[model samples]
Structures are given as structure tokens and as C-alpha cells.
Target: MLKEFQSLRLVETDFGNDVKTNPEVVANIYSSLLAKFDHNSDGVISLEEYMTETKKMMKDIANDIGFMPIQMVLEKDSLLMKAVELHHSASAAHTIDC
Candidate 1:
């Protein structure tokens, strides 16, 4: 995936691929991308790290949102939905116990 990501020919510039045609800037960009994606610094992106970063980004977006209700669509069987169900069930049980 990293190889594929690095192979993109997306950079278009007035000077034409800058710093000497298809140049060092691409490598620099990929290095920065790797640093961001490879959170564990193991030089690779694992599923866990990706998900952790994703959840942090979602929380950031949620925090940026104010007052307005944000609608999120999730499959009923998704783990997040299941977590919501479990919390509701536990709250109901706690009310009964009280």
C-alpha cells in the first residue's frame, strides 16, 4: 500500500514536477506521509494504528461540532452500535438495581 501510495503521479506544477522533473519533493512528501501514517514508527502502518488515528480524527470532528445534532449512520450489527446497546442495557439494569 505504501508503495502504491508513493507511486502516484498526482503532483502537477508550473515548473513541471519541480526540483528537477519527477524529483526529490515526491520522496519528501512520501516521507512525511509515512511519518503521519506509521504512528508506531515501525516504518509501516498497522490496522490498529490506523483505527486509533481514525477514532482520534472522529473525536476531533465531534468536538469541533457545536450544539447541532450530527447524524451518524451505522449498521445495526456494527460494534459501535452494539456498544450503544450495551450501555443502554447497563443503564437500565442499574436503574432497576437502584
Candidate 2:
């Protein structure tokens, strides 16, 4: 995953300044990802482990980057709040019926 992310041409470029890319950042990120996925710390993450971690990380990124503005809007909008409440009620009813 770190290799894949590094392969991405998403270099931070400022006009004429050479930004020093920290290899340690990639290492740290990979280490953290591996630790999160490798429950037993066996130096290998299985497919299931990878998928589980990927899903969790994606959800976290989504909540952090995508949901912040929506959450703020929800906080300000009574209509949205009512709609969310209605949806929650419907879901709860469905679950109870099930």
C-alpha cells in the first residue's frame, strides 16, 4: 500500500521550492497500517485483514474529509435533522420488524 501510494504522482509542488519528501513518512504510514491490519504482528497482513483495515480507513477518511461539511450543515438545518430522524425511525422500525 505504501508502494502504491508512493507510485502516485501526487507530489506537493510549490512554485520553485523543492519540497523535501520524507521517506520516514511513508515508512511510518506503512508501519501504522501494518500494525492496524496485522492483529498478531506476524509481519504479514492477510487479504481479510487488509480489506478490513482498508474499509475502516476509508470510512475514517470519509468521515474526516467528506462528512465534516455535511455534519456542519446538519447541525444548522432543522429540515435535515427532521429528515435524519425520520430515516432513523424508519430504519429502527424495519429492524424491530425483522
Candidate 3:
């Protein structure tokens, strides 16, 4: 993910893309993403947090993968769907706001 975050130039990944990779921006994103999975609010994500979040995400994606197209067409909403929308919106907004 960090590699992909570093590679963000022409396109936005989970993190925003920009013309430049400033240290502050990198740090902000690194910290924000780290905070997301760091359930204990620690500076680092524990192995348990990492594995649990990974498994949850895998289950979420696996369950929804088949219905994604239909969901998009139907505009169905859920916490995961809303979070993804907010993530993309915030990625763009954060770049501009920062």
C-alpha cells in the first residue's frame, strides 16, 4: 500500500495522487491509514488488528464481489459502500484542503 501510495501520480490510489510527494502529505496519509486499522489508537497496528481487519475486508469484498455490478446499478448503500465513497471524496478533498 505504501508502494502504491508512493506511485500515486497520475491516479489516486487509497491515498490521494498529486503532482508532488511532499513529506507532510506522505506523513499525513501514512498516519491516517495507519490509524484506520490501528484499533487501539496506537502508533502502529498490532498483528491482531491487522489480521482481523484483513479478514473482515476479505469477507466484505468476497461477499460483495458478485453483487458489485448490480449494487452499482441499483445504487444500493451500506456502511462499506459509504465508507468507500467517503474515502474517495476525502482523498480528493484532503488534497485540496491541505
Best by lDDT: 1
lDDT of 3 at 16: 48
lDDT of 1 by residue, 34-84 (tens): 788788799878998888776666555544443457767758876565555
lDDT of 3: 0.63
Write out the backbone clash pairs for model 2: none
Clashing pairs in 1: none
Q: Rank the candidates by lDDT, best first.
A: 1, 2, 3
By TM-score, the better pick of 2 and 3 is 3
**What's model 1's TM-score?**
0.44
lDDT of each: 0.66, 0.63, 0.63
Worst 10 residues of 2 by lDDT: 58-67
Give the Cα-based TM-score of candidate 3 against the true structure: 0.45
Question: For each candidate, what TM-score against the reference?
Answer: 0.44, 0.42, 0.45
Q: Write the per-residue lDDT of candidate 3 for residues 1-98, one digit (tens) a residue.
A: 45544454433454643445576777677667767788988556678998888767855664555556654432456655654565568668989998
Weakest 10 consecutive residues of candidate 3 by summed lDDT:
9-18
User: Model 2 misses residue 85 by how many Å?
Assistant: 15
